[model samples]
Target: MAVSQHASVRKTVKEDLGAIVEMIQELADFEGMSDGPKLTIQDLLRDGGFDDGVLSNSVPLFHSFVLELTEQIRTGNKGKITSCSSNDEPLTRTTIIGYAICFYSYSTWQGKSFFLEDIYIKPNYRKRGYGELLFKTVAQHALENGCKRLDFHVLAWNPAKYFYNRMGAENLTESEQWEFTVCQGKKWMHLPKTIPSGSKPLKS
Candidate 1:
């Protein structure tokens, strides 16, 4: 049967913390950004306090229900790791075939917008229409929220550049007059919760 014939996507909630961590690790490895998870299992279990907040803004938004599709077992013949009953159960996807991490934000250029921080589908899953579905879902949400655009970035080495091109996401290169800088981790961690006036760009 065709892959799309069974194409399904569901949302997973926060209670399935282990699965979220595993999928994240799988995604990191598959992207060749890193093979081993940068975060330990413990990080997922306890890094955020019982009252602690969610994923960092720059890290791609993973809210309580971020990974709805795989977590909920709403896609394909596959089901949750916890619910499968067969001894000969098929191997669960060890790589992230498709994902979208996003948030609502105000963009000076596009007014209020839906910023899609990341979307990825494993190489094997390409041409299956899953990626298009993911995009459509996000775009639809943005429209629902009255967003003028849905924005995201793709790295230079990523193979999906051509695919994004067909989707009409133009190549954005650096311009001479203005500069873009990114600050991550260590420094961002130490910054005050609220920045004082005239503070230089601080991440943490």
Candidate 2:
């Protein structure tokens, strides 16, 4: 599956936010973690730090890249893929099949690094090299920005482990003594105060 011939990757625009949010929900559903997505369009816009055309770390928490089909791919009764007219403008009516969201961080020991927070492709569109293309796109940005490493997490049960390993990703658990940990689950929604101070959790 030659990825170049299928889809084009680009930075998402304001108009693409709704569809991107939908894809995020689809990913969550596939993982069987939750039903709807925890993030919202407004939240994305706020934390994404889209200021006067620059991604200032002080404002936005993450950056994203969207993969859109070049040809029309039916998503719903009315959803269809469209093209960007001027190359710089966002495509209208285009079906976004996948996306890669990342956030930059300092690794202390390794210097600069970027975490691939979320990468997902519509199930129907998987196995066509789209996933690899998305991964490479994010990696390209990481390198261009002087990042020493790119990190992300995958469920131990996920078959995608084979793909990651094939691409030279290391398994810290087996290769070293580092551990991966996260804070969520039972105590998440029941928190006494908002985690980000003024932000609201996604609607249940």
Report clashes for each candidate as comma-separated counts. 10, 0
Best by lDDT: 2
lDDT of each: 0.57, 0.78
Worst 10 residues of 2 by lDDT: 72-81
| Tens digits of per-residue lDDT for model 1, 1-204 | 111124444443335555556656666776676655676545543442322354433343432223232322323244445444465343333223455656778878769888776665555666867787777777777798799987676666877778777777766554334334677777887676567778757668
TM-score of each: 0.58, 0.73
Off by over 4 Å in 2: 1-5, 51-58, 72-93, 184-204
lDDT of 2 by residue, 1-204 (tens): 111235878987777778888888888877888764778887776677654335444756888999998642233323333343333333334568999899999898999999998898898889989889888889999999999999888888888888788778998877786778757887775675646766766769
Instruction: State the displacement of the C-alpha of residue 85, model 2, in Å, after optimal TM-score superposition.
Output: 16
Residue 184, model 2: Cα distance from true site in angstroms = 5.0
Model 2, residue pairs in steric clash: none
Estimate the overall C-alpha local distance difference test score of candidate 1: 0.57
